[model samples]
Target: MSGTISRRSLSSPLSALALLALAAGAVTACTGPQAASEPEASRSASPETGQPVGATRHMIDNGGHDLAFYVTQGTGPTNVLDSGGGEDSSYWKDLVPELHEATGATVITYDRAGLGQSDAVPGPWQVESAVSDLESGLEQLGVTDDVTLVFHSQAGQIATCLAQENPALLSGAVLVDANLPPFFTDERIERLVAFSQPQLDAAKEDPDDPQNRQLLSTAESFVATSTAFHRATWPDTVPATVIVSEKTPFDGSPEDVQRWKGAAESFVQAGPHRTLIAADDSSHDVAKDRPDLVLEETENMVAAQR
Candidate 1:
């Protein structure tokens, strides 16, 4: 998939109060490595060509949370990764660096607020607030332009919001097993409420319990409360690629797997500048379960952009 953002355009600066509100809203909303060997074996056959690899890990203050990200520096547009629901940035631990090494494009992965090292906001994890936090975090990292966002699962929605409001900042987006907006139906909302009730009840019982608070701050509840906000704010245009998982659990039926894949495929087909790939060997956690596949697909996408 190919998409473009006009570099000639400029983003309106956020007012100080708006910035503070973004920060404050964020504050009130939520509440990897590798090694190598077999050098001689590689020498037996010509060594495989690969891009130079360089990565740095750092913590950035986003709102009240200390968000952690790994920046793999290279040429051209940077790839910003968004983790799946219920996962930390480590979701891309093995795959991102490989993509960077193979493609020579900068790759970034971060823990969202309330996940990993980042602290949770107080209440209502809205998508708009999340997008603001992302924009601010990217600004803090000095990566304010020419970005290729790679979003997994529910993050596709947040990425769409960012690209819509600030198209100049994004070059492209890849949605991996992404959750689309229109998919948020009343049945899904009911399911989310059912999924979040226990945690919400626990948090109500004892707000001081960090564990309970964290559980209550799940992405499901966050999406439920913020769906309207997302619906109201649509972007002008953004390029995207969508990937679907084809494998299933041992106990899962073929029909169940197909149903899940169908949902993902629908989202991909619905978007402009989108392509869908069904990874047969992988399940939901494609990055972790099939890093090679993730790396290969990412490299292909980045190369196409070039």
Candidate 2:
């Protein structure tokens, strides 16, 4: 639909593939909390919203690499906000305070490897490794239980794997227009790979770029990763809230729009605690468009846990 795909689009496996295919040459891309009390230098105020940015910044080691996380300390259940592909913790800057103030729960946000202030890791991006990065960060922060994860876009994949692998680490989840297993059927994967071929070829010209690196890495393992992801299940023990955008990631194609919405529906229907909320008049970036709703639902989830 649009002439170009934003880096945030990279979060959705299919959305990025389809949009990248359409744009071909016109793609623009581009946390942790911790043991620290240092103020963030680069982040202070949102130029647009003027909201104060994230709290104290800290860096933690994930294996040999460093990942950045920011924390706004509170007392209740911890709310961990994760961005989609090509995005960092700053994406959630505005909402971080709102969430902390409303729920009084510590709000933690981080940059994935190679994005934001986090160290770059060579090779393609792997879901398992992303899970490890999150896992390591949480454990190091002494956050072992009662974490309410709020993930958007591509982070959904990581959230899905984490839920299955470490249900005990999470109390509830808010999936903001994230990817789901039902959407990654064999046919969809085939179509996604086909559409993404042009972008994959384009990425080769600048593989060193962070955005390109992610694209290359994702393309390298998408087939197998998505296939496995499709087979993976979310733990029924974890309560989840699924927020589907009005114009899902595939807003350009009416056919894809239906499929994306249907997949989210299927994901919610399959579980008991899982609930689906429609984000009206929003694009793929639901948090940006409907911060109120995101905060409301997230606070509700935290309230439910208490």
Candidate 3:
């Protein structure tokens, strides 16, 4: 959770609903086959959720916005490593390569708008737009593989929405301590919105600074986070598992842990294919604290799919 990120890198906070994997946590996933020699049809290829061949680092043109994304090729079903909340793709450093090696499938990771190298839209950030970018990014990349999406913390909203809307696109999913939309009530949403407003105000005042822009970007997106949860409908078709952390990181209260466990239990128990696991000796970042358990669940999901 502690590392030196060069000047003005406003990475999502460690506890702000996010998690990461590893494999040379360096910047720029620019290494792979050169895309220049590929045909236009091949380069502009992937289906909405399919994987692209011979493409590594690239920018996506999604409705006038340029989103920075990168892919590490592998084998099996495409695994989409999406971190939650203020996080970008870099957070999943430790887990990425493990899954890639285990599944032998192309792993897709990227910075959401304004998070890393992705460009920010001018208007206030919304959940729907963020999800749109992900779907569109895959299509633009010309990916059409069966995907097993991995979501953590706040990014759970995107997972649920996608599962509900496009069940056929996903083969299975892993909720790595994900946030269940139904668990967020009115009181919770108000508190989160309130906590983020001050930072947003300060960033607006100093809009020119890089740090300020980063703060502004997170704040704007967070504004609608709760509402997105409210609007989301959990899909019944997506076979998934909810991995819960025994140690509390998002909240310190004993009640919060119980609440999370309760939500996770209900989420997985709703369907026969789903299950819940209480990750032992783990924090919110379970992937880092207990990589074996995380990898086990991931591999299990792939096996079931196969």
Best by TM-score: 2
Task: Between candidates 1 and 2, name the one with more favorable lDDT.
Answer: 2
lDDT at position 7, candidate 3? 17
- Tens-digit lDDT string for candidate 3 (1-306): 122222122233523312211111111112222222233454332443233344465677676677766677776578887876566666776676677888788888878877766777765445556667777777666665588888887677677766776677788888888877655666555544554455566667878654456455555545355545655555676788889888544444455566667778877766667888889888777777888987888888888888
lDDT of 1 by residue, 1-306 (tens): 112211121011100000011111222222111211223333121212121134455566655556655566678878888865456666566676667778777887776677665677777445677786677667766776778777776576676667667788876777676555554445444444443454455456875454444444443345445344325333435666667766522114444345446655666566567677776667556666666766776676677767
TM-score of every prediction relative to native: 0.69, 0.86, 0.76
The global Cα lDDT (0 to 1) of model 2 is 0.78
Q: Lowest summed-lDDT stretch of 10 residues in model 1? A: 14-23
| Candidate that scores best on lDDT | 2
Counted clashes in each candidate structure: 4, 9, 22
| Candidate lDDT values, in order | 0.55, 0.78, 0.64
Each candidate: RMSD: 12.7, 6.6, 9.2
- Which residue pairs clash in candidate 1? 28-123, 29-123, 31-121, 164-235
Model 2, runs deviating above 4 Å: 1-15, 18-54
